[model samples]
Target: MSTEAVAVSAVSDAQQHTPSAPAQEKTVEKVNLLGMSRPQMEKFFEDMGEKKFRAGQVMKWIHQYFVTDFSEMTNISGKLREKLEKICKIKAPEVVHKNFSKDGTRKWVFRVGDGEGSLVETVLIPAEDKTGSRKTLCISSQVGCALDCSFCSTGKQGFQRDLTQAEIIGQLWMANYSYMEDVPIADRERSVTNVVMMGMGEPLLNYDAVLNSMRIMLDDFAYGMSKRRVTLSTSGVVPKIDQLAEDIDVALAISLHATNNELRNELVPINKKYPLEQLIAACQRYIKKDGNESARKHVTIEYVMLDGVNDKPEHAQEMIKLLKDLPSKINLIPFNPFPHAPYGRSSRNRIISFQKTLSDAGFVCTIRQTRGDDIDAACGQLVGQVADRTRRAEQWKKKIAQSNEIMRSQG
Candidate 1:
């Protein structure tokens, strides 16, 4: 049997034996205004017996003006403000912990709610180009990932519930407000120039919330980011790829870590459902220029390099052949190590050689620089505290303990 088949069998066995956690019951009343799109917000106001324009006014106050407190909305009448305060809430995730890396990378661990509250992580990567410093916020769409890729730390934490639209967009709002805390109010244009949905979970799995949040990000009253500036990274959810092309026009990044199905199936289990050929076909459809010729966008192919696993020269040659026809750029990421991580980062020399192979093949290949690793904020290193619904967290803990015991015995 193939490595992927063995892994899949193991996962199936685990699932068959492991017991699931009991579901909780809770009641929520107030409307969280953070994630609703323009139409939804307008409908909300209309349903509340207020003028439809109140939605736009409130959206501007909450998003553009950075005013969360209803009392701070100065232009609104006192009676309206009181009514809004009683019925609505500008809900945002609470920042339970914040860490700043030496390279100015910032990571925030946000608390989602009460009673074994789920935690999600967001990362701000600072980059300096010829123009100026650009900050990109990597936001999470779910509390934890369900797709358990062997190499990802977040997947090790086990499956958790999808985040609400508020939780998704609130990440951007909180990051922007935190960045502009010291700047003058009049000069505060958002510090986050780009946003990427590549943090904790499979974004496509949480489609509606992610799409709604992206719309809010592109809304003029909110972040006002260009479609090119926002990216949605997926682990090859084939159907969602086609859905996204119809729903939004943001840039797409595929988390394609391996060259073939034999490897990819083990690295990304979703490949088992939607294989490489199907995924590539979906990408072709996604980038098809239906009517607009000038708006053609290239998909970003993200390949994480793991030492002695998928970083060989042969792998690079295979990648060149795989991506030959697609309008794409390859982003080679060096593996970021986490506690009990099964793989090691590819050597710098190996990474350089891999980039050269793709560059020689007439592809635009760039090696991603490692940032925020010290604070566990780099790629593939986000592991938030999740009350695992699948009991996979306990299994991971036991595996790590066994590994440590074996090492101690050898010593």
Candidate 2:
């Protein structure tokens, strides 16, 4: 599903920037501080007639120390803490269902947007890199998706709403907190070192919130994550790609599942609007870096291998041709099937052959190991409960039913 949805009504967008009221006020309005970046938080404190330095202190408490309660911030004076307790709140989405895979992958199903069954998921995967053990958190920017990329289970579930900045970054906050909650602040180290925005929704669609969340992630007082450690994956949102290059410096990944326009249009319907040529041009622009070849970065091309589709030698050769001039790394993901999914994973030999072709051509190619499939936490398996506004979920259900009936008749 697409990322153009907000779970709120007509006037909800304006509510994010409004100031909170103290407990003495009739409404006792509270502003959620979980989503605010350092600048926003500094403005918040300034507006509250407090010192701007309080922003860094509070941010360190909330992000580094994982302190949600204002009263628990001992270094801050009791009066200011009391005032903050009355008018401000550091809150994250509630974890509804938490599951762990045997392979050290963890998933959390979060309840968001008034809790009307609009669920989103987050995943934390532990792995080993050249440095040492690293945990990468897969964060979702939207509840469900609007871009119905035919192979994705979230698209079958349909789009519901764009997650608030708090909800978007809360997945990372919650995941990091899960590990450090029992440890002392001085001795605690970050559990999650990397983040990938490749889960659930198209992140660029929820532009502002996603951007602000990444800002907070890169802030030193907050998560202190490097721009290199955070990657934003999209289904070729062309204009946003350009805007992202201007706005932030995070690594970019394209969800490119096909080599040609005709097949891509069928697989990723958004390709109809932003075709392959335009998409590749945008990626090139994103990594251009003022044409300095020495400091140029590479974009990541994510291609999911299907049994008889997009996995043949011809397709690999076409991919090599498509990416010959661009600086990129190719990740070949095995198709993870969900209920009624129309595709199947390519065989190991076929995937190997495809990887060999690209690798032999002097491009970096790696196969993504299937992980957390049993718990439905693999790459394409996250299907959080979505209140489908597009009615795409109902249509998919009908389509599945028709396919099942055809199979039964043939039997």
Candidate 3:
């Protein structure tokens, strides 16, 4: 059997044998085929005593045609379709709430699990470039994040479980399906041109699901998106970065919020475990391939500009020295604030000055425009209702409350 087949079968067998809860909690769950890649699906069919080609037909139905019902697949025989309907499903997450920004950014709050608190947000951001207009869907990997990056609101919510493969790819499926409501599949143009795994959680933490989902995104039977157009952002997970280089090839972005070791350690706690030196070394290795488009592919250094935090001229100088060897383009993101957030957005002048330093220093740096802030769908602002498993949310709330009390008392 192929590697994908073995892995897929192992996952299927493991889930099948898992213990069920009591009658009150127990519910019939069908295999959701939404997340499976082509090779995995081929293996699934081979295991079921069906032709492997059935996998491609089913993939086109689910991803390309956006047909959720097995009955709608006219090409498959009635008997096989009936069997698939009985044992499997093509379900995506339920979208509970949706918001459209005046700037054409769309946000959806999806219920990924059974409870009310299982919500995760996905955003579609439209941009115009030299080529043409493009829409990028930001995908969430986990329900909530464990990495407590000081400025991000999602981190304030604390850790929750990693999202399954279905939940991960469902974001793209739903985003694209939204446009096909009125138009027929043949007439439908791709609504989302690119995808960025930069939403609610640290992506590298949820490795397997994320990798398979991304492979689906790149697969011709599915999204057929270019590997470069699909970017996966991580908060400096070093080992995964190396492992990722081996498993698949896609654009990688580092959440390098701060430049130096001390500031980065304070801002992104993951920095303490995987320091700037280690992360930089890994990045250098990641972009080392030759004689391909990936050879010219530079790692994106995502820096969120916080007022008096990491937006200083000295910080820009630090970034220059740090990224001197690595081929990277710096993206300066203006901080987006949320309730009781510790940091403020860097002033326009300060951000401009910082960008100028890098631009002049020969680093291709661009400031990220703050978008969908009205709907709280902007970067670092996605805070879906998380049933925080860590109790870190409670601690964070208490800390914020105390800070407010101290200020009020001083007044």
Candidate 4:
């Protein structure tokens, strides 16, 4: 989205102003209070003369417990909690709008701030499995995306700034909180067991903040989630994939929509820069690990099945060869379409045959059922509104309207 297209609920222009710099030096941009990890938060609390373990307690309440306001942490001393409220902010972008799919998927439109103002859009997908063990949250890494994949709505919205670690993690905290208020407390914490960084932005592009957010999620005192539960999906950012494996050691999923260099170059523009060969090599290196059970990592190749495009039996066979001997699985995600996405979902017959080919080749392959499309809350249908003061806002609204109409028709 254009800078002018940022919405009203976002950080305002006044919020972007910087104080005068010290001679010859730039003013220190105030650190975003939300991004700090539990240990880091503890250090800050200690420096402020509060007890050390207070950080752990507060972290648990904020992350696993989903307490946004300090006052809600009733066990914390009123005085100390009040002090925390004043010094740091636990922010959840205001949910200006929300929608639920018949399939039980939820998407919320939230306002996040940049130097200019706040912008919005996010989708939360609850698992549909009757007996599945995991509940997952799909989150946005940017307000909009820079990587304009030919078949993604967020991509067409164009580039917006990367979300800070807090903004990224805040989505989890907010979604968990919202979900908990409706469910029994006994079951709320267990309800959300997985997180996928597959929403809007190119995650590796916003590498540092993404890593920080991952650490917070994996922190035992905070979210206490296993490294295996969180998956960071990327569109082949070859170089950064290694660091993600080494530093975070979480599950990795690649957006490998096409089989060959030609189709991939069109489906994912990044393929042109780091084509299929280099990207596959990166995945191979990522699969190798040197530690205990926790360190043994694997990659998931997320293949979006487009009609007559990359959904053929030959394509599936080629995929098996490409991923041979790697500790990996193939996730055949049927295309979730939006306005101008330029593609259609593959026929069920084609999808089944493709899966059969891979399974016959001794590859672990599963066709993912499409969910949340009715509410525009599926894999790639997340785009939110920006009520600008001028014509640019109108342009954005038109695209959003058109996208929503497509969802309505599909439903």
Candidate 5:
């Protein structure tokens, strides 16, 4: 059987054997090796009746040497490696699908265990102009998304569950190893230069796992990426934003699709719970606490320009005004349309005009070059799972009918 089919069947077997639970208490069957600090790994070994220092040796083999099998930790005894393998799974979700864009962007689709089994997407983007200076990996925090932002395909998938720390970190490990294996020795780098949590979910909602995964990525013995090189993107989960600053203190990016509250509420539905005023306040605090040269951080506000929606010059002016006096950078992304999404991409002239307004207002604004749209690899284009036709079709029909009734009443 194919790798994807085997993964699906394994998830199916799991669902048949175990019952579902509350969102906060979802059970992840195995611990992954993606997010573990040297100290934490040592503690794990100590708990398992091994010397604490053995954790460091194993961590070196896993993260630095990229060893996939515990038995390959030659420093440890073969009998101990066998015991560890029996009790813990050290591998990542097998890469089931791989797509590369003409612009050196690569996307990998992995099968994650959710109800009936689900999939998640991640991307590795190379710097433009052959800078050879940076390679960034876009990582996902959840299997799918619960935050149904009107413009996002992953949001449309509905919430399944959060990925454990292992799952989150495994993306980096697997991608790094795979890349090293593919490229010539002369062109290869030591590790992924940057990490962005902008792929599939509202990251702050899956806070703990995301933080744990980041700890591993930032640890000196592991990925060791600087806090400035790591960015946590959020759809304005207000309550957790401040805590994120206090805790991990990495680069922060906000998905600010609309300039005002009413429009924002329409685009990113979470704004209804935490409005613009509260969300900006959280950003302000995050900046005051973590923004500086030592941290090497900048608050990036991602504005998705939607035609006749948020692409107006006035909207651009308001965005600049809102962000003024704050240490920030604005990334104006032209909306990338997908099937079933109602919005269209903003016109090129409109996008340029809007960018000019922000730049003229003394804000650092750049238009993100759209990539991988031909293969559904652009922004808000990750719908990882194909819904089970017979079951979800009935649910979709009911949902469409309900929407029609609401629209009829409004009209």
Candidate 6:
């Protein structure tokens, strides 16, 4: 079947199997306040006949103080707190599983809803600088990916649905609390310094929820992270790239795995629609200066180095020509292996040669060090427990098992 046909079938199957609400009486669910933007919170308060400032006070309590219980919000009036308790909820996902790598990398598997396989994974990588330790949290926007990039394990899981704003930001909420549990309250600010929406799915595909979560990340009453510190990576979603720049100016990273359209079309299926030329043009537009000097940014070109695939010295020369006019840096990622993966990580000598080619051509290039490999939390290796509607997971498992059996027989 064609990809479009499969996607349509999956959507239909999901709707058919979804449980419907009773027709006699409707239950009103309390709003989750964890991911609400300042403006959204203000409007929420306005509906409750409260002043706009009440939203800010409550926001600081939830995000800054990490207080979910309304009674603990000392600054809020008792009557107002009572009202909020009845109408709003600060819900974070339950951490179903946690794993820590020897290199200080931590991964959390969170259950978003009460479904059988509603799990999503988030990773926290710790780094040190001149000041102190810094942690970067990688969060997911969807349960699985619709764009089945050949190189990504998450894509092999197939699409489920887009996460709500609450679910997306809740990952960070839980990560921050977990990382700072032992730190003094005054020193908690160093827990999560940066965030990347490059975890399980294509963030641009779930635009509104992702953007709303980003707003909460940048809010002074919440995480208060700089726009530069938050990044949203896309696998060449052209139109959304334009929309994202207009909506918010967070740093942009493109998953440009291949230098040419033929290879990218095979690796990143979305390239068939947007192609490489349109994608490069979009990247150029994203970094264009409007009025703010801070907005003049450089896009990070992410290239996963697969053995014998798009990692040759000639490929690097082509990349230099392709990105010469754009303000960007190359991030060479070594392919992280999984069961039944079709590619191998490029040898160290091959990677160094590729990097040298780009560097000699006057382009800034940095190789990304692989982390959390032992715990399956590295780049392109996140495959959370998704109740896949497309049945792609079952097919992949069968294929891998068969391949293994055949190899054993031959040996």
How high is each candidate's TM-score? Answer: 0.88, 0.91, 0.91, 0.82, 0.83, 0.88
TM value for model 3: 0.91
Q: Backbone clashes in each candidate structure, one number apiece?
A: 0, 6, 0, 6, 0, 0
TM-score head-to-head 1 vs 4, winner: 1
Q: Which digits, one per residue and each the tens of the lDDT, describe model 3 over residues 1-411? A: 632343345347423212323447534356678888888888778887789999999988888888899998899999989877766778899988888999999998888777564768899999999869889999999877889888877887776678888888889999998988788765765578899999989999989889889999999888889888999999999999888888888998999999899999999999999999999999988887433366237999999999998988899999999999998999999987776677899999999999999999999999998888788886435453433456666787788899989999999
> For model 5, what is the alpha-carbon lDDT of residue 16?
17
Which digits, one per residue and each the tens of the lDDT, describe model 5 over residues 287-359? 7883444453468989888889999978987787777766788998888776545678899999999988888
| Ranking of candidates on TM-score, top first | 3, 2, 6, 1, 5, 4
lDDT assessment of candidate 3: 0.83
Question: Runs in model 4 with CA error above 4 Å?
Answer: 1-34, 72-75, 114-120, 128-133, 182-190, 292-297, 379-411
Candidate 5 ranges with C-alpha deviation above 4 Å: 1-31, 114-116, 129-131, 182-189, 290-293, 379-385, 388-411
Clashes in predicted model 5: 0
lDDT (10s digit) by residue, model 2, range 301-368: 99999999899999999999999989999999999877667789999999999999999999999998
Record all residue pairs in model 1 with backbone atoms less than 3 Å apart, i.e. clashing.
none
Q: Please list all clashing residue pairs in model 6, or write none if there are none.
A: none
Question: What does the lDDT read for residue 386 in candidate 4?
Answer: 39
Candidate 1: where are CA atoms >4 Å away? 1-28, 182-184, 289-296, 379-390, 397-411
Error of 5 at 310 (Å): 0.3
